[model samples]
Target: MNISYQLTQGQIGMLISMPHNGQLIPDDIASTMTEKAKLVPDTDWYMDKLYDFAQAMGIATIIPKYSRYVIDLNRDISGVNLYPGANSTELCPTTAFDLSPLYLDGKSPNEAEIQRRIKNYWQPYHQAIADTLADMRQQYERVVLLDAHSILSHVPRFFAGKLPDFNFGNADGQSCSQALIDKVSALDLSPYSSVVNGRFKGGYITRAYGQPEQGIHAIQLELSQYTYMDEPSDQYNQQKAEQVKVKLQQFVTCLADFANAKS
Candidate 1:
C-alpha cells in the first residue's frame, strides 16, 4: 500500500531524504492539471540521482513517489504556515513556484480533499521518516538525517537575489548539534558558496524530528540546481554530476564520520 515512495536502509546511522523528488501523479489528479503543471517543473529534479552516492555509501535513503504537487511532505501537515511573510507553496500546492496556477479552472482540491490527500500521501511518508529515525536511534548512539533538496538559483517568489549553491538549515541550531554544523560548514565548495540558517532554515521534517539532546541530529541542505544541473531547462548533465558528486561524496563522508564519531 505504500506505493508512493522508495526506502532503502543502509548499515550506517544516516538517512538521506529526497522528499520532493517525486514525479508521479494520480490519473484523476493529472487530468485536472495544466500543461505547465503536468511537467512538474518545480520539482527537485534528479535529486535522487544527485545523491546516488549515498546508496553506495550504505546510507539509508527515502524518497517519495508522487509529485510534491500531491502533498508537500516537507511542510507541516497541520496547515500552519512555515513562511508567513514569504510567498510559499502549501501542503497541496495549487500554483507553481512562479505563482502560476497548476490546476484547471475550479479543479483544485478543497479542504476535505486536502485532508484526504494528507492521510493518503503525506502521513505515510512522515511516519516512515519517524519510524526510521527511531529504529536508527536504537542501533546507533547518534543518527544524522540529511534532507536533500534543490531549486532554481533564482525563484523570485521565495527570495530576492540568487540562492547560494548550498543552503544548510538546522532550525537555528535546535535541530542539530554545533559539531555537525561545523564539519559541514568547513566544506570548500570553491566557486560555489554556502550559508547556514539563511533564507531556508530547514522545514517541518528537520524542525520536528531533530533532537540533538536525544542524539538525533538533522540537517537540511537546499542546493542550487545550477551547481549540478542545467538550470531552468532542468536537464541532468553527466559531466556536471560527476564533478558535483565529488563534493557530495565529501559531504556525505563527513556526515557518516560525525554519526560514528566516539563521544
Candidate 2:
C-alpha cells in the first residue's frame, strides 16, 4: 500500500511529521490483533488536528496511515533499542505498554513475518520523510523537521511517575541546531519545562535525518496526553485541548519565526 503525505502551501518548506498518529490496521494484521489492540488507545490521538494550524501557516506535513502497532516507523529498523535500560516497544510490538498481549493467542508475527512487515510498512514511511527533507533542502537553504507525538502522562510500565506536560527531545542537542532549541525553549511554556535528552529523547526519525551542519534540523516533541486528550482513554476534550493549543501554537510559531529569520 502507498504511504500518505499532506503538504501545505508554504514556500518555507518546513515539514511537520506525525508518525504515530495513524490508527489504520491492515486486514491481515487486524485479524491477528486482539480487540483491545484494535482500539488503538496508545495512539497519539488527534495529533493531526493538534497541528492543523501548520497547514494555514503554509507548512508541509507527512502523516502515516497505518497504526504504529503494525510497524513503528519511529523505531530503529536495525532493532537497536531507543532506550537501552528502560523498557520499550520493539520494531513490531507483541505486547502493549500495559503488558497486555496485543496479538491474539498464537497469532503473533514470527521473524520472517516481522521482516516482511518492516519491508512493507516501515521502509516507506521513512522514505517519505527522507524524500520530504531532500525536497525541502533543495527548495530552501535550511529545513526544520518537527516530529510530533503524544502519550499517556503516566505509564507506570515505562516510567516511575507522572510525566511533564511537554517533553522536547533533540537527542541531547545532537538532532538540531542550538538556535532551534533555544527558540523553542524561550516560549513561556512554564509548568511545562522541556528536557533535552531526558527519558524520551529523539527517536529514529529525529536521530537519523537531523543534520544541523547540513542545514536540515529535526526535533521531537512528545506531549503528555493530559495536555490534550483524556488519559488512559482516547476521548477528546475540546476545552482542555484548546488551552493546550495556545501554548503549542506559541511553540511552533517560534520555530517558524526562527526558520524564517535564519533562512
Which candidate comes out best when scored by TM-score? 1
In angstroms, how far off is 97's CA in candidate 1?
Answer: 0.5
Candidate 1 TM-score, C-alpha based:
0.97
In model 2, where do residues sit more than 4 Å from their true spots?
1-9, 191-193
Q: Write the per-residue lDDT of candidate 2 for residues 25-116, one digit (tens) a residue.
A: 98899999999999876788999999888888878788888888898889997899988888899889888888999999999999999999
Candidate 1's C-alpha runs over 4 A off are none
Residue 95: error of model 1 in Å? 0.8
Cα lDDT tens digits, model 1, 94-207, are 999999999999999999989999988988898999999999999999999999999999999999889998899999999999999998999887767899999999999899
**Best-fitting candidate, scored by lDDT:** 1
